[model samples]
Target: MVLPNLNWRAFIRSQPINIMSRSFAAIFAGYLVAATGSGLLALIIPLPASQSVLIAMMLSFSFYVAAAIWAFSVGTSRQAWRDLLLISAILYIFILWVS
Candidate 1:
């Protein structure tokens, strides 16, 4: 059988699509923040190299969870995207500065 044509406008405006967008922000953006935060910590912590790396990795788990919370707690998916992307940009810039 032939496949039906997809309605791009309806798909874009649907509630589930909105939720999916927010969920993507939560999982992937959260991961980006966590990874960037870990790298920053690894550079900045004053411990021995190995110890600082370990501590940074351990502490990054909290960053991941907090980012997920931040993504969902916002009023809208667009706001979620805005806030998370802004945070990711800031963290990445700091990483560059620290390096």
Candidate 2:
């Protein structure tokens, strides 16, 4: 019986850092952006605060799902991070400006 040898180093080396970074951003940072943006939107919308919060809570998951999809769909990890950060920053700035 012949046993196949696994080259762990080669496998590790084959994985790109950008992909890992992107995955991290998708899983963690993306969620943060979505949640923050949703909360900010909830605050800024014309609806009553209570209603807005309720709606925002309901819709936050959708934003997270969409962000995850976008993170993976982009051409590169850097682009994904950049887009997510840019969007988050813009939303945050808008929130600050509105308040």
Candidate 3:
């Protein structure tokens, strides 16, 4: 059996967050969602280490935001959008507290 190789870095760079796409509406929406989420948590959660957990939470949560924006832009239903946002919020909280 033959398997196709995947280039993960290339795939990731193609995402909305990449600098070249920063002005794209979807990318902007993802950033807005991520920033809003981070701000809310920063208000509720006590600050901790700056380098590791905090940064990781920001990065991962941003990706979740990007994925969500992509999903909604592709005509995902309102229910799906709600579910994805809820799941991402939960995941962000879990990561913030556990890490």
TM-score, structure 2 vs. true = 0.77
lDDT of 1 by residue, 1-99 (tens): 997898998888688998898899989988988998899999999999999999999999999999899888888888988888888889889999988
**TM-score, every prediction:** 0.84, 0.77, 0.34
C-alpha RMSD of candidate 2: 5.7
lDDT tens digits, residue span 1-99, model 2: 996897876655454766787788788868878878787979877899999988888888888888888888898777898888888888888888877
Against the reference, the lDDT scores of all candidates come to: 0.90, 0.81, 0.54
Candidate topping TM-score:
1
Q: How close is candidate 3 to the true structure, as a TM-score?
A: 0.34
lDDT of 1 at 4: 88
Writing each residue's lDDT as its tens digit, candidate 3 over 5-76 gives 978778656645343343343444455456645544554565574544476466657665665556555533
Which regions of candidate 2 deviate over 4 angstroms? 1-13, 16-18
Model 1 residue runs over 4 Å out of place are: 1-11
Indicate whether candidate 2 or candidate 3 has the larger TM-score: 2
- Note each model's CA RMSD in angstroms: 2.4, 5.7, 14.2
